[model samples]
Target: MNTDRFKENFLSFMNGCEFIYSEFKNGDFGDLQRVEVESFNKMGAVEFWSSGWVGIDLVDCVSGTQEISVLLSPEQRDLVDGELRRFADLMARR
Candidate 1:
């Protein structure tokens, strides 16, 4: 997994974004990380896919987001859900 590309894309997506919180994990597949970015009232989860090609998905809190699949390596659906849940939880606490 080329993590350099992933980081590049992540930073691009986070343009003008105010990072609220983030999490990292050393999983069985690879090193997975979740970041919550906010711009004004817009909030979404950015999951750094470590097992596949440098890829990430944007999911709106009120809008249903599409999931991206690159290969049959592994799915980080739980991580995505967890990021959203945790982001909301953290935002609520603030």
Candidate 2:
């Protein structure tokens, strides 16, 4: 991955998306923190939870299917995934 490009895109996405944060207790993991961000156009969302995990999905508002991988390149996905994990780790410190 191109670190510079990834960082640039990740920052741009985070700045643009609608961000929400919440924390809850899990039986196995104690406290879990979650951060969710939806694309400006509402076509994609990324969910990041504590403990080194992340999820990315492209939404189809009409069909309600999540098979819209064409909206993002593999490199873009990887960049988002890595940044989310990093964000989760940062949240853990708070």
Clashes of each: 0, 0
Candidate 1 residue 27 Cα shift, in angstroms, is 3.3
Provide TM-scores for the models: 0.39, 0.40
Which predicted model would earn the best lDDT?
1
Tens digits of per-residue lDDT for model 1 on 13-90?
344666644545676546665555565344555455566422344444444443332222345443443443344443
Compute the lDDT for candidate 1.
Answer: 0.45
